[model samples]
Target: MQDLTLVMAQLDPLVGDIPGNAERAIETVREARIEHKADIVVLPELFLTGYPPEDLLLRASMEARLEAARQRMADKVARDVMVIVGYPGRRDGGYYNLAGVLYNGDWLGEYAKQVLPNYQVFDERRYFTPGNRPLVIEHRGARLGVLICEDLWEGRPVHQAREAGADILVTLNASPYHQNKPAERLALFAERAREVQRPLVYVNQIGGQDELVFDGGSLVVDAQGELCVRAPHWQVGLMPVGFTHADGHWVPQAGECEPLAEAEDSLYCALVTGLRDYVNKSGFKGVVLGLSGGIDSALSLAIAVDALGPDRVQAVMMPYHYTADISQEDAAEQARMLGVNYEVMPIVSMVEACNETLAESFAGTPQDTTEENLQSRCRGVLLMAISNKKGLMVLTTGNKSEMAVGYATLYGDMVGGYNALKDVYKTWVYRLAKWRNTQDPVIPERVISRPPSAELAANQQDSDSLPHYDTLDAILERYIEDDMSAEAIIAAGFSEEEVYRVVRLVDRSEYKRRQAPVGVRVTSRGFGRDRRYPIVNGWQPGE
Candidate 1:
């Protein structure tokens, strides 16, 4: 029977843990062969050293470590099942991202990734020398062509593989998650599969790597562009895919297809996964955040509790003189409902002391955002102190909308190791809060309904400093995400004045965003790695 059973091992690999990841891959492949009768096992791209190892790839010991891993795998791995594993290889006076096949305790062949993606969160070109040729290997009457993540996305690699007489294609990916990315990926994969006219197996890594969360929606597609099997998203598992060769073509057998999560659900899961992996992988004791009784903080608090659970999360309400009674009440209520350690550390005295100490320096100046920033900075100091004392990571609660408009106080509200809502817009913050409530009513309703405020001054709403969130988010999506000009935004029906104002704010705030804490990226254009801009650019849109 010309039937091949491929086991897609969608896994989470910690960066720099070469021996551990090798052991895990070996054991998993062994189990697949013995238990599931898998003919071959496939792991995601750069699984050994982990994807985008960054500067770790430049270390002197990396090649030696990889050589050791290769020797160990060759020694311990059984000969029953063929395994395709990805790792970084140093050859020909350069380093290449490679996928090699190991079978019968022998390294059969290897393929270096051709297209090195350098945009957005990816910087593969900086570290890897792109391979010029396609690699096709034969195993048990099957011609399997190997392609790494970016290789499959570009047309040449797949067409070249087909020309190299490949019967089936196997791709390894460390593709990161952004909102609606899975759907977009599927559409692209289907197009590629149809274009190449070959059955393909796509395996992706699952879990978070700092800001990038890889949702494991590994799948199989037939030559006709039909999706045959889909592994669960944001999950780590080995999904089996069977393919049979008929007359002259390979076709994937019909199998399980997991339904995609809804928009809010997927984004929430990405946040939870990103936060969970960032804390757990970094070896943090837990997480602590100042939970203001507002939508952003409330959503962040809920995500923290969900990511690390109640015992591992601590919510502190740092109230000032201007902080409303309702804000405190809602904050405490949400913390109690979530069953986390809650505290109220009023910053009135801290602010007063700072003012008194700086009175002489600021004697001639009238009170402005400096005083407001002082309040935020006090809260930041307390949060950092608690984090240091307890050895827990501080979780900042600023959203993308605030980060885009220079609304968040740098070294103040932006003081944290991670921000769960960093890529989420303020408008989506409310939607996510409501969605979280559907799962469990941990967030107070009052918090979601209340108009957002920094509570730095009397009756100071977010609208006092910026446009309404709905308007601000819309303009930001167009200007920042879509790269629309101010004139284009005006043409799209937004007021010219508001468009110019929002555009200017987003442009000027690049410096602060450059220093802000890394957060989960749920949008296509997150502040950190996704959107990069110079701090001193003189170009103005519609000028």
Candidate 2:
């Protein structure tokens, strides 16, 4: 029987680091060949410059950089192994996403990605011209068909490869993470494998890129649509799968099949990976956030600690008159438990000083949210100062539910460089907190059970200005993610008043969200990139 060992290089490449990525590709090929006896190695889509290079693809030097990277790969990689890598190529004066095959220090063949995804965090069409041909190459008595990330999503590409006498289909991907995304990919690819009647090898990248996180769940399915191999998620490594040609078909040998993480576990890991990569890649000394002892901050602290370690995370509790004694106690207890540097800096004097300065301007104004917001602003100023002095990124702790209704103070509690829970709803915050406790028990029990409050004003609870989190999140998800109209949400058992109110608030809060720092996106439809609303518009809440 003819045998082939294929290795999937599930690696993380920093965006725009062409030379470094090329070196990494060369090293991975060498390692695969020496360790796994791999005859063929495949990397993720756009592995040279990382996925979603965005405007970097438009630079004049992009072609030169890519060519340099290609040359380096060719010169350094061993000829005994074949490497299939993804990079942007210019043909006919237009760019195309291409997967090039290299063997014996020469080009074997290349396949241009036929499909370009343009929706929901993908704008490939903006930079790439669609390709029209299929590429299938013969190696070691087996015909290998190559496809890129979006090409496998469509049908014509796979059909063309099969029609071209291909024995196995191989796909390179830089797919991002969202709730249940791994499952969605498996089901879709399993159907594709069965339709084409070929064993499919799928390779995906891992790590965080800006707001996107690519979970490296590289996998393989046999001709009958059976999963035979799966690499671990939220990890970077090289996975090997051996295939033998028998009975006129290439059959994949069983390999490591890592179990998929559960819902809460996956979501929590995504948050941690996103935060860790963002901090390390952005060159920050550490992260510091105002830990108000509420569920949101408590969970944010836990995530930061888990991501960058307690040594790299600092917590500052800025309490005011409205801040309760229990809040301070919980905050301190959690910080101590996590072994992070914790400090308490009261904000009462700072708020009074701000009021004294604005006394003349507010002489006729009755006490309102404006004064309560001052307390938040003072805490923000202190956090930013600490961040600037210590080179730490200020982590904002506002959840999606609060951000949807404008409950978060702009330039106040919203002051930060990154937010770990910006896309997570207030309800999920509690769920994640409880789930994390099962893992390590760092968050205090009272922190998870207590009613969430801003503590900006005396006797003020979040419920005072908004619906309960369960009701609020349900309405928000329907309107924001599902794109349901206000009338439709009302018809779905929500009260008409609450629907209209929440819808209006979401619409008017576009400006605040625009200014908010980018954060890890766990849901299919997050506030960034995916949801784009005009800050100045006359859109009303209606059907």
Candidate 3:
């Protein structure tokens, strides 16, 4: 039998852009044929409409658009190079996630996705009907088995495909990025390859869609469970793998094995890719954010600069009476180092105006958090005004730890179009800042060394109202990400008072988080679509 070459097309597709995605796939097929001599080229899952098309799958024109796109690909794709692409299609009078094969201007058999993931960031069951059978096609001296994203995660799909007389398996994925997800995927695919005793080729999409970022770390594992090819994360390209039928088994040839990045580096890249795609895809001219010289804003500014470059980012420092001189200095210094447009807009007058306006309403009430919140509101107003006037989106700088405990002000500091650090915890924020500085000494050392504060009032520190971030983030991970109850968290060696207090804050802050702008999701349990909770609930903090 002759040898065969397969190219994994790890490309980004804009959601709802059917024609554009089809054109991209055609071009990728042509490139794979001419550049890599690929006999078959595989695109990622939902390449026609992009992954998680959500309610777009329910549109009246969905089927018509998909058929038109399929015809377009058939006309433009290379005739000799076989193409395996994923799209949402109608079969047996039901909408299903499908992988269709096209070769030599003719339609080959298609495989409907069997396993529909309905957890965390996925809602596939809401739109697609699951397929019950497996599909295996004979092509280029090898029998090929096909699967979709979630199919490979389950045991039955892989086993069924192998049992259907397949020598090679290919799976298209739009799998998203979370912490340590790449490593986990590698381990899982290796085990699957060993179980099926067939070479496995995994193709994944790369881009940011809404809050989800798909890191394209595509992989290929040999029949013996050894990795042969690993496409670099956060990249878009055609990765090739060669195979030959030997001893009744298709043996994959070793190819490029790009090393996985460390946790900090990978997290940093995910943030940059997510922010860049979000801004560019949304057609924003640029981004404007308040630079408070705190760790959150410092890290956020650095990420913005890295994502959109200095010319596309603007930093505004709005200082009040309580604002420290060092805060202003650090903000200005970092902006200067990053070569971004920096401006200082004092909100003292704005705060004084608001205080005068509210004086009559607060005649008998003593001054409290209400007065402190005015400063943040004034800053938010200035930032929003600048964003509107300059045609730039405002990027909020609050981190996950703050958002989890209601430490942020609603419609005040939280006013923005996006938040880069929303899913990132406070502890990770510091680590990202430190890691970024290693790439370049832009963030001031004092910014990393000093204690965190809102600077909204005299001697204001985050610790004044909440526990230390180290303890707070730990409890929050258990309560929010791990779903540990108050009692469980306390049993995990945390103080009972701190556990209950943190849990209460998280539960109470759901309304605020619901109103906050969408942001990048780097964790498994980001506040947006990943976790759903009732705004008005009777559930208490205890188990």
TM-score of each: 0.98, 0.99, 0.99
As for model 1, its CA RMSD to the true structure in angstroms is: 1.3
Look at candidate 2 and give me any clashing residue pairs: none
* Model 2 C-alpha lDDT versus the unseen true structure: 0.93
Model 1: residue 342 alpha-carbon error in angstroms: 0.6
Query: What are the lDDT scores of the predictions, listed in order?
Result: 0.91, 0.93, 0.93
TM-score of 2: 0.99
Tell me the tens digit of each residue's lDDT in model 2 across 1-543: 579999999999999999999999999999998899999999999999998799999999999999988988888998788899999989887789999999988887889999999999998999998989899988888899999988888878998999999999999999999999999999999999999899999999999999999999999999988999999999899999999988899999999999889899999999999999999999999999998888999999999998999999999999999899999999999999999999999988999999999999889889998998999899999999999999999999999998888888989999999999999999899889999999889999998887888887778888988999999999999999899999889989999999999999999999999999899889999988988889998878885
Q: What total of clashing residue pairs does each candidate reach?
A: 0, 0, 0
Worst 10 residues of 3 by lDDT: 243-252
Model 1, 1-543: lDDT tens per residue? 479899999999999999999998988888888877999999999999987699999999999999889888888886768899999998888789999899888898889899999888888888999998988988878999999999888878999999999999999999999988999999989999999899888999999888889999999989988999999998888899988888977778988899999999999999999999999999999999998888888899889988999999999999988999999999999998999999999999999999999999999999999999999999999999999999999999999999998898988999999999889999999999999899879888988887889989999898888999999999999988888889989999999999998888888889999999999888888887778789998988665
Error of 3 at 466 (Å): 0.9
Q: After superposing candidate 3, which stretches have Cα over 4 Å from the reference?
A: none
**Residue 487 CA displacement from its true place in model 1, Å:** 1.5
